[model samples]
Target: MNVKSINILMIDDDAINLKLTEVMLKKHANVNEIIKASNGLDALGVLDKRGDIDLILLDIVMPVMNGLEFLSNVYSKNSNFNIPIVVLTTDETVKKEAMSRGANGFIAKPIAEQALIQEISKLIDLG
Candidate 1:
């Protein structure tokens, strides 16, 4: 499948981290759109409009509506999205929690571009 067809939603509160992630992924990874949301509530809004997203780059902790909370809402309401989710974080504890919440895969923050792509590749099979 063409990478350009997949849409990516990145949910995080930090501007610098979001910029870095966008910069890193833009280098080679092609996608239809790369949407950024500062919090889970904002992300849910995006997800509502675009339910065909192929992947989500989720951060476990945030000020308004954390990733886990987002996942729960997604699972409960967004029946259309059986989308692959890659939890991005620096915390190991949050990783465990995110996994339990239904993340397809995960990679640590200080986001490594290749590692992110690798995780996405694994989940893209479903996409």
Candidate 2:
């Protein structure tokens, strides 16, 4: 899969998680660009500046606004935009709800290198 032109948006509250995920994405996906946001509210700000984001790796728990709220807001704000969002979380209980809300996929916490790339590839049809 040639994802050289794909830009990814990564939303998480933890700085460590953000940096680690960025490293993994750089190593595995070779993505065009990875935009990092500390929370969903900040993520919305990022979206305002960049409209070409192809995918979003989002965390469910965050300050200001959570993943589900972000999803709902983004959808409501711009109903025409259809970027794929992959939820990153530790809890298994929210899987159904997350999907129902608008997540294209899910990645468990303590993210795996292979799984991350695989999910992104599948969602964007990288292969």
Q: Pick the TM-score winner.
A: 2
Model 1: per-residue lDDT, tens digit, 3-109? Answer: 34677899999999998988877775456678999999999899878867778999888998988999888888856558888898888778777888788898987
User: Worst lDDT window (10 residues) for model 2?
Assistant: 1-10
Shift in Å, residue 108, candidate 2: 0.8
- At residue 103, give the lDDT of candidate 1: 88
Task: Choose the strongest candidate by lDDT.
Answer: 2
lDDT of 2 by residue, 44-76 (tens): 999999878999999998999999899888888
Model 2 regions lying over 4 Å from their true place: 1-3
Model 1 error, position 66 (Å):
0.7
**Which residue pairs show collisions in model 1?**
none
Estimate the overall C-alpha local distance difference test score of candidate 2: 0.89
lDDT of each: 0.83, 0.89
| Superposition error at 54 for model 2 (Å) | 1.0
